[model samples]
Target: MTLQNDLQSALGFLNQGKFKQALKQSKGGMKRHKSHPDFPNIAGISLSGLGKHRDAIPYFKKALALAPGFHDARKNLAQTLLFLQQGEPAMKLLERVLKDQPGDQAALYLQAQAHLVMNAPEAAIVTATAALARDPRQPRMLRLRATAWNTLGDEKAALADYQAAVKVNPNDADALQNASLLLARLMRQDEATETARKAVAVAPQNVEARRRLASQLISNGDSAAARGQCLALMELDPKDTQVLEMLARISSRDQNAELLPVAQKALKAAAPRSLDRANVSFALARIADQAGDKEAFAAHNDEANACMAAQTPYDYEGSERQFSRIMAAFPDVITPAETAPEGPRPIYVVGMPRSGTTLTETVIGLHPDVFPLGERGVPAFLLHPCLDKDQDFTPEAARDFTADDISRLPEMPKGTRAYVDKMPDNYRLLGHLGTAYPDAQFVHLCRDPRDVALSIWRGYFSGSSLTYAYDLKAMAHRFNLYGRLMQHWRQVMPGRIYDLRYETFVADIEGESRKLADFCGLTWVEDMAHPERHEGQVLTLSNTQVRQTAHTRSIGKWEKYADVLAPFIDGLNPEIWPEIKG
Candidate 1:
């Protein structure tokens, strides 16, 4: 085949996600016309698309070498470098691109997302805002701004940007999907459902959108429709693990064992991810237990346990530095105005993503006098004063503060003394939380690092924001860093943080709740044992699980699969409640 034809085929395959084929074709094209003007450029695009990032570097360099001013090739090369985890180099190219063409949409979008992920949200917002100004209706740009807003603690603004993007591009499946997820959490059930429905309608063949809408419906108590949607999604992508898992979870009436076969099917096919396999196995076991098939339940649980991956310690020096930079950028936890607690009041629960945060929040919510904010951004993340205008935040994160902003913060709500901000990722800003409400008690929940690692891997998270979560070792390192930070907070900001344990809570709910109550300076409420009964009160992701109360079954359930946890089995800190590590 001619160089051009091979390149064309490579482009086609690249766009189709047939990376291997694209790589093959691009290599073939390069060999045919090693000297062609555009061949190197095509080779660069195709090879990078193929994920042969290192090999593609020369091609992009060659392309730029041949045509020094080719914006398209330059842009592709820059982004390709970023994809190869070469963020600094990519930043240099993007900066050059922006210097040349300040209003370049692709450059701006790429630069913004890149910066956001690299702990440069202020820079991301700056570029993203410029991108939006040039093309206000650009779906990607809008989402970029929304994300930047989110990272900077402007939940309302983020929602507004996302909503606007959805409005401008009603058929944008991603926009609809995110809007649904966000609104659902914000307690706009009807809007969330409608938005998700619209997303499914617009992209009828999009199995993901269908699944999302269905899940939202299920959460909103529209299980009947959720089941139908899940079934429909199954029809399109029969083995889509997410669809299969959701179906298995929803169709409990179809004989608990029935879903097992489906889950097994998805698992056998390597349907989506390892997490799905774990979830399916767990769900099947749950059903078996319900069905009185103890042996079968044990077996399934054991198999699910087998899915536990191994672990290795990560020498994530670069990541550590980046995290340090992010911490430096947003140093203080921006909190609501109520600096001093006059009495027992709303406590903000801040920690990492899966650190026993939800459980701690639920315990706090169990208090009769306190209201549960769940994970909603009420005194929202964006409520921080520094979010105004455009400032890319640094990882060495510091609060963008002013005396006036502090002055304007609302006083303690009439009678509500304790409000909980259960932003798990808010640990990086613990001091800010302290400053936000000197009187507010901050509970920093910690769990076994191994359990957190295994849990995250065995779950489907936003694979984008938390790139670290994809790898077990990275997850462990991140967890360790979090532990170090919490430990530091205790040393410096002692008395403000109450470390909660997952195992202790499981072993003795009453004991833990009373301890929690004492920590928050509240009278222990007897009703906390029935955590699920306070369903409406939970605003975090645990809404579904909190329908009744605490269940002892979840604690230490990892034992069923403890043997299978190869990758992250022992990645936890050696001193994590030394009594329990054994």
Candidate 2:
């Protein structure tokens, strides 16, 4: 065959994951045409096989330079960019490829990939949707579409796409594996388990598929099946962090200690990524607590304290003022939002992150009728109309919801007698909620702005949404806005708002718990004392803390990190501290 034909054949071999065959074919092809345009592309693929990411970039670029229309080389370059941690630029590069070749299935797929890495689900969905429109049969595109939908808070849409992706490519291990994960998120445990099985059925070599299946089985409450899946996965890839995390979970379940180190080592080897740190840290701490090592216990405790950083309180007067405007403009949906809800009168968990809202919610949830569903962000998703990108909340907007808006609550939350809506950032949407459920209870949860700032700086939230979490001054400005708007809510909705202090919740748990229960229309119960009893929902980054139930451990936990937080919350008006403590 000619040099070009041989090079194309080599690439086809590479695409099939036949590294040995691809390397041989590529070597032969390059020998035939040492200076050919495809030589660099072939060499890049071979280098990538050796885990030489940095070295592969130039070769991919060379291929593109020689053959400017080489779409495959561009895709490889984008992949290399992602590995280099230059994700935003990589996305732009992928976008350029798509612009040059509209309807290019591969380019579109990579673009969706870059969006996911950047944590922009809304953007992910838009790009994924366009990609899907052009190539519905591409299983990877379908998977991307599903992930994008999930990020957009469209659970049903995500499931549909996942299903389509797997159905179109049953042996596509990645598709099956990812589809199963989305199924678990949708709470379809049994189906997810089955889907995970199918994933491994095709690609038993794909370690991640096995891990995903194992996790789904465990979530389904089928511990045995999950463990079996874990075993199969370990046989395939013993160094997988997620699989190790699962093994640790199983070890704990069976009262076995051997798997603990195995899990820890795997995670550490993975370089301690961001998303899984909260869960892993909590589990690791639990492991240490079992070993009777006080220092380990202290470190774990510190981790819990550290996790609160994502809970940055508000900043900027404009944000809060805008939120207040939104709340005031909020039109009431439920005609009798005031009725049926009695007791602690529903302690509405308000305040920005690091504002002690979690502590407040934990204390209150301990009360008999109070359910501390950690960070159930459903309220925030449904109350989007009230969220203006940058516009001040206008009363005209609040009254604009139609019948569809009012019907949302009964549809979303299914069954519950006056449950607490703990959407922290909901302060901005509270007024809209007021109109939606006019009679629904409210609690303007707060904490000393300084303490809130300190709490945030010390804490490490795995799923942070803003850049503010990493910047103190800017974060403080954000906190000021949230607090100030909260202040506005108290003023306009006088006698309607009550503040719960994070510090006071620990200092006076019983009293606060009692008051909080009453606020939320719940009859008191002794079980509320052990907030740890209510577990299993991975609602937010505080999964570990919520799992242990609410306690005073996190309260005043930032005393060590105090010096760091002082500058941020100190900028906020002091008027709110008195309100939170009382």
Candidate 3:
């Protein structure tokens, strides 16, 4: 064929996805028109389509060298560089492309992708926002911006973008699944379940969509529906570790003994030292603990801890430094709040995780006039802003409270005389709470530290912020800080704070429940002792436990795992152990 005819044949073959034929035709055309940019560009396209990206690079360079102003060839080269993960070079080329054509949507999208691949999420957010400003209906651009926001730890912003993406394309599976997960993390379980269900409905054969639906179901406390979804995932892929682990958890919760072997068999057959194996091992540990197999429990618990700890080890020294700074500021900063109660007052129930914060809140929630805002994180948000340039708190910061600051606080339920904010970590922000809400009261829930540590270790927590729970020494450090901080609060705000010991409450439920009700300024009600009957959704790890009648069996539960826990709790203060053990 002649030069023009040969190029035409190659272009036709490329368009039809006959990459090998296109490459042969382009080579023949190169012999006739060796100086033409289109010949080399066609060859590059052929090689790229045939999955030979490295081989395609030289041809793209040759095309650009021959036709210095060929925009399409430059764009193709940038895309190829991005595919090879040479993001710096790809981004440089994209910057050149954008200088000429600032509104080039394709170049902007690739630039954003390159930034994200290089772990520069802030840059990606800027670039992706530009692309979306040009064409807001583009689902991929919306999803890209959502991912960048999530990487920046802005979940609400990320959720907003995901919602926008779903609205742009209701059938977009990625957007639907992402929005569902964010909703779940925000503890809007009912809405999360509906969104995840839509994802599954849109992409029925997608394994991840179904998995998200299953996980959301479990979080919403619908174990029965989650079990069905897990079974469906098994049909999709019998060896999915997540499916196996989830099945193990649901089976253990349901007391379905036979299903445990299915999970154990898959776990035993899995390769050693994998995260999947570690997770399943942890699941089996929980089952063993429930079955009273102490030896099995100890062995599996160790394996799981080693695996998880390797991934996210404890930072005991770092944590100690941070807590020391917070405590050191107490003498100057831990004073009374200046603002009076503008509306419904808030009573905080504060303590370590699994230290009866939920139980105390549940008991207090039974009072007809008290609204329990379960584990709301408003104070944590407020405290972060008051830190100085060195990230340390100062007395000056504490005293700067304004009545207008109450506007920033989370709104209490509309028609209640008083509300309970039962965030356990509020123990760390008692000083801030004291200054911002002078009328606010505090309830400190105290539990046996050994039992507290054991509970935290035995259960799995979702966030990296709780890294201390994954290791023993780290847990001891956490427990110690909590004890010292509570003592400081008692000294600083004596009569405004009330302490409810878990052991005492368990032994004398009526007396302790009445005391809790009275402390919150509510008249004692007989129903306060039967918190499980209060008809509210508890969205904590203790969701299952709180729904059952009060029981004392969890008292002294540390003794059962004493052998496994001795090494971890060994660093605990000798003086504190006696106080808790008594």
Off by over 4 Å in 2: 1-28, 34-36, 47-104, 107-135, 170-237, 241-284, 300-389, 395-420, 424-428, 435-439, 443-461, 465-488, 495-582
Span of 10 residues, lowest total lDDT, candidate 3: 386-395
The parts of candidate 3 lying over 4 Å away from their true place are 1-91, 110-130, 148-156, 184-187, 252-256, 269-271, 340-346, 365-389, 392-413, 416-421, 523-527, 534-539, 580-582
Worst 10 residues of 2 by lDDT: 406-415
Q: How does residue 463 of candidate 3 score in lDDT?
A: 60
Superior candidate under lDDT, 1 versus 2: 1
Clashing residue pairs in candidate 3, if any?
A: 337-434, 337-435
lDDT of 2 by residue, 1-582 (tens): 897689788989788877667767876876787667687787788778767788888888887887888888888889887777667988877878878888877777777778778887777778878877766787777777777776666666777787787678778787777777666554455666788889888987888888777666554445677778877777786655455555555555334366666656644643332434544554565566567664664565455334433344324564556555565553342232333322222335777775656545655555544444445445565546446453433444444342333322222233334445566777775565565455556777555565565545434444545445655676766765666666666665655666766667656656766776676666667655555565333334344455454556655555655555555545444554444334
**The candidate that achieves the highest TM-score relative to the unseen native structure:** 3
Score candidate 2 by TM-score against the native. 0.62
What tens digits encode model 3's per-residue C-alpha lDDT throughout 1-582? 777788789999999999999999888888888898998899998998988989999998999999888878888888888778899998888888899999989889889989988989999999988788778998888888888877765667788899998998999988999998887656566677899999999998888999989877765567788889988998988888767767767666446366578668877876666677767787788778678788987788777767677667778777677666666666743556555755778888988999988888888877777777677654565465443223444445554443433443433455677777788987887877777677888898888888888888777666666778877877877787777777777787778889888989978889988888777778898988886675565667786677678888888888888877876668677665566434
Ranking by lDDT: 3, 1, 2
lDDT of 1 by residue, 382-475 (tens): 4343333234533223233323223223233356556565877677656555655556687877666556655555443432445555565566
Residue 69 of model 2 has an lDDT of: 80
Best model number under lDDT: 3
Superior candidate under TM-score, 2 versus 3: 3
